[model samples]
Target: MTTLHTPRLTLRPITPDDLPRVLTYRNDPEVARYQAWALPATLDSVAGLVSDQPLGAPGWVQRAVTLRDGTVLGDVALNTQGPQAEVGVTLARSAQGHGYAHEALHALITHAFTDLGLHRVHASIDPRNTPVAVLLTRLGFRHEGTSLQSYRHRSEWTDDALYAVLAAEWTA
Candidate 1:
């Protein structure tokens, strides 16, 4: 399992004990609003998802983002596609606006590109999520384009903006 340490957070493989906190953040309408799917997440569903993660897949990694104090605050993942990977993140409401997402994501991206030998890492965000767009841009992700109605959330189609950063663009 891959583990990444940031100044205020640790990103490590998801475990059974993290189910409750994961559901707490995922079930929130505010947080689910921007996600690709908006299912009412249950413990069983979370367990299934975590169990299904492709642990041995080359260049694929998923980690639970926790505080140094051991509070599971969210999740960060790198889904591989040839030389590129898709980056995904979800943070608890309480952890928002404190730079934890950026910090954790930065660390994850570094590991993906540098250690995992990926050439590019990308993220897709709901166009309405201005904060994430700004964050990605600040992290050197260039706006790649948009996918119309690419995400199905709550039985509705939503547009997603694709942003990406090349390995050469990463600084930290």
Candidate 2:
């Protein structure tokens, strides 16, 4: 079992029991505003989204971000393909601004660059998601570039912001 504990959160594979908690944040308009997934994601869809996360599985590894009291705050997802990986984070509306997202992201980045031996970790975000962009920058991810109108987010086309960090940069 691969589990990571930060100062305030435990990162573990998303389970079937986390449906409601996951949905609470994942379905919220505030959280889903800049996300690629359609808002009001159904329970069945959320279940399928996390069904393949088995510990250190190589495809899409999604971990439930939980507090010390076992309350699900949100989730962090990493997708690995070949030598590179991309990551994303989501937090409940009620859990924002607490540094929980920061803690969870730091732990996951460490795992990606150290435990997994990935060459580079990257993130792509809707250009309008300023908070996430700021968080990624603070974590030492350099803004690589922007892909204009490269993705269709929700019902409209949106630009994508690309950011990345190398393994050497992380281990330093």
Candidate 3:
């Protein structure tokens, strides 16, 4: 398991104990608005979801983002493919706008490129998510393009915005 640290947060492997916090946010309508998980995430389901992914493997791994004092603020998901990774982040409602997401993601991206030897790190976000778009742009990810009505989300057609940062282009 890889543990990443930022000045204000730590990104560590998600554990069974963190499932309650994970369930809370996963069920929050606002938090799930842009996410694809089924609503009302149960404890058993959350555990199953976490247990299903293999950490440090060629697949999705979830990391719990915490404050230095160990307060759970959110989680980051990384789906590793041979020389690339797709990343996603979710924060507790109270944690939004505090820049913790940026700090945690920066650490994850840094590790992905520098330690994991990935050639590219990218994120696919809903087109309606302007905040995340801004966040990715601020972190040096280029707006490659948007897939029109790429998938049906919550009974509506949703566009996906693709943002990417190349290893050579990354600062850390």
Candidate 4:
């Protein structure tokens, strides 16, 4: 498993023990509502998702965000394609707005671009998710464009904003 440490957080692989905490954020109505998959998250479902994939695959990295105190905050991952990787993050509702996501994302990006030798990382966010969009911008991600009706949310189609940051563009 791959593990990374930041000033205030640690990013590590998701384990079976993390299912309960993962479900906390996954089950949140607000969180799930904006996500492409809106079905209620169950332990079995989460297990299935993680079990089907390997951590730190050749082109991908999936990790659980945790605090120095050992609190599991959420998840952060990089799904890779060639030299670019797609970033995804989910923070526990209670941990939101505390900069934990930012800390974890920075660490993950550094690992992907520096340690893993990746060239670029990007994220697809629902336009309605203003906080995430703002967060990505703060992290040096440029808004590339929007995809119309690109994702299915609660049985309806929704638009997504594409945001990207290049290795040379990252200041952190």
On residues 1-172, what C-alpha lDDT tens digit does candidate 3 reach at each position? 6778888898887788889998998888988899988777888777854544443468788888999988889999888989999999999999999998899889888888878888999999997888899999999999999999999999999999999999999964
In candidate 1, where is summed lDDT lowest over 10 consecutive residues? 48-57
> Tell me, what's the RMSD of every candidate?
2.3, 1.4, 1.7, 2.2
> Candidate order by lDDT, highest to lowest?
3, 2, 1, 4
Error of 2 at 50 (Å): 3.5
TM-score for all models, in order of appearance: 0.90, 0.94, 0.94, 0.90
Question: Local distance difference test, per candidate?
Answer: 0.82, 0.85, 0.87, 0.81
Top lDDT model: 3
Candidate 2 — which residues are off by over 4 angstroms? 52-56
Regions of candidate 4 where Cα sits further than 4 Å from its true position: 49-60
Task: After the best TM-score superposition of candidate 4, give how far the Cα of residue 140 lies from its true spot, in angstroms.
Answer: 0.2
Clashing residue pair totals per candidate (backbone < 3 A): 0, 0, 0, 0
Write candidate 1's Cα lDDT for 46-149 as tens digits.
Answer: 77446445432555466889999999988887888888889888888888999988998888888877787778889988888999999999889999999999
lDDT of 4 at 111: 78
> Model 2 over residues 107-161: C-alpha lDDT tens digits?
9999987888889999999878898998999999999999899877666778998
